[model samples]
Target: MESNENEFNPQQPNEHRPEQSAYGQPDQHVTNPSFKSKLELTIFSIEHLREIAKWSKFLAIIGFVGIGLNVLGLGFFFLLAPNMSPFAAEGLNIFAGFAGFIGFVFIMALYFLPILWLYRFGDNLKKAIDMNNSAELESAFGFLKKHYKYVGILIICFLVLYGLIIVFSMLGGLFAAMGTL
Candidate 1:
């Protein structure tokens, strides 16, 4: 049997068809869905994102708990250092302990920024999906972008720091060898 031109057929490609999406623009459905466009990600993939965000938010809260516990440890050690006798306290080097605590806290604060971003991303994503709010959805994705950007910059900073440490050590070694001669 011959198919009629007016009848819609799955086997036939219809390029001229104008299908409306949420807006009046033609619906752009991905034939090869290996990669999704932003529109597809925001609209169609929200359920997946919500699930991911739920888990991520849980983990970030757990991390915050871990940091709080670490603060207790810092306090414990800090308190222990000062209780020693005056001479012993000097030998114990409470200042070093204090410095270590400060440094640890500074690092933790740096890490907390990314965790905050992830938490915001997760919370906003969950809320946006529930409310079907575009503004909230955009905020969720913006936090995700900032999380990535901050992590990338942190990695670059660490690499540069490692490079500087290596160069300084090598120079120190060369200076020691010359001084020995």
Candidate 2:
């Protein structure tokens, strides 16, 4: 009986397999596909992600405070509007009062808008860290860098608007004084 020796050995290492082409010989027919050539891009680094997570609570707290302040401002305006001569004598018409309230609410939202992005950034960073996607982790850091400016803008706008409101209130007081005179 003749014994055949060509059968592949299961115990042999993959490197020694017959199917492997010549050493250092690139596959000419296999042009590199652009998609396959590169690894997936992620947003954040592990260190940055950990930092974000560490500070997430602080950001959340700041957001909560901002939201609370806005709510207080809204309540103050609503409570005072009815006592003012403009709305009081006019009976605070439903449509106009509602419109004004909406506008105030919109402005308040703008003031607290950074809180929204901060919350989102923290959440996304946490998720990326959990998923172990370094690229995504870096992306989250990039997002924070890009949007922090917007947050700053929101803060500045809120301060400016608040200043305007105070100026108008002072003017109103002056008019009341003139009326008394």
Candidate 3:
């Protein structure tokens, strides 16, 4: 018997794959493509999801607090930068304060979206489970996906940056060694 590559086969080892359930269960739709509804979650899965929602909400709240702290720190720095010994000089104070503020803002901006998505995911998931609304469940998963994708992109960017830093550091060392010889 010949098998079609496009068809999902549960028996096959990675030969074919199908979309998983939004709640992270093995979708039965893999075998029966015509199934329109998402697989229902078991009691065990619901408990697990509840725990996850609680944790996600906690972490997101912490992240928001951290951003708030960053804002306060930035304000405090500007207020005190002129008084700090090293940056007391007008020119040095302005430049250092501005640079620090810019860096802090950039970091905060980079982290804000992922945290927001996480918060929304947790909120939506909790509501969905309580009400048994499929639309809310789908929206919750969408937020989760966005949270992961945004973080994944950031990780990739940082990895490439680190690789470039390493390459450049090596090249600089090589040139320095040859210059001394």
| Per-model TM-score on C-alpha atoms | 0.69, 0.45, 0.74
Candidate 3 Cα lDDT to native: 0.81
Best by TM-score: 3
RMSD of each: 11.0, 14.5, 9.1
Better of 1 and 3 by lDDT: 3
Q: Candidate 2 residues 1-181, lDDT tens each? A: 7633433432333333223222223334533233222443345555665776659747767877877887777656655455642466677645455667778777667755566656666876877677765444555565576468887776798899999999999999999999998
TM-score of 1: 0.69
- lDDT winner, 2 or 3: 3
User: What local lDDT score does residue 133 receive in model 1, on the 0 to 100 scale?
Assistant: 67
Q: Ten residues in a row with the worst lDDT in model 1?
A: 10-19
Task: Give the Å shift of residue 141 in candidate 3.
Answer: 0.5
lDDT of 2: 0.61
**Candidate 2 vs. truth: CA RMSD?**
14.5
Candidates' C-alpha lDDT: 0.73, 0.61, 0.81
**Of 2 and 3, which scores higher on TM-score?**
3
In model 1, where do residues sit more than 4 Å from their true spots?
1-38, 41-44, 81-92
Candidate 1, overall lDDT?
Answer: 0.73
